[model samples]
Target: SGSFVVAVDTDVMGRGSEELGKTLMKGFLFAVSQLPSLPKTVLFYNGGAHLTCQGSASLEDINALADKGVDIRTCGTCLNFYGLTDKLEVGSVTNMYEIVETLAQAGKVVKP
Candidate 1:
């Protein structure tokens, strides 16, 4: 299959209720983990940075994805802005240029 990537720009999955969104995000990650064909990479930025760091409910699933060879990356600038520079639990830091390249080079991009 052609390479695909997931781009998360928020800590939650949708707008409105924060709790519901978080719950959905947790489930979303878990569902992704169950897929036979995994994403080539998962990029976290903006509020999405919170999901790959400490205190996130989705950490276990995200880590599982990482363990399975998914390239997990969180924006370095976003980590600093959120004061989570050292709390990254699942992935390494990445830059804007890399983010752009990843998205651009991907055959398909999924946002959820």
Candidate 2:
């Protein structure tokens, strides 16, 4: 299958109240995990780093995706920038180069 990827650049899914956006993000990730064909990879960067770290509300859904072989990656610099380097719970650290290459190679890219 072609490389289908999802890039999440923020902790929230959209504009509006922070609470509502976070709720939407949780629901969105859960829905993604339930997809018949999961994305080949999920890239977490910027505020998205929060979603893959410990204490995150979406850890369960993200972990479920990981269990099914989705390549979960969180930006190393972003984590450090956010003081979350030691809090990561579900993915390997990646850099901008890898992120760029992955996105460039992806057949489709979904952002939420």
TM-scores for every candidate against the unseen true structure = 0.96, 0.97
lDDT of 1 by residue, 48-105 (tens): 9999998999999999999999999999999999999999999899999999999999
Spell out the clash pairs found in candidate 1.
Answer: none
After superposition, the stretches of candidate 2 with alpha carbons farther than 4 Å from their true spots are none
- The deviation in Å at residue 52 for candidate 1 is 0.9
14: Cα error in model 1, Å: 1.5
Residue 26 shift from truth in candidate 1, angstroms: 0.6
lDDT for 45 (candidate 1): 98
Q: Report lDDT per candidate.
A: 0.93, 0.95
In TM-score terms, candidate 1 sits at: 0.96
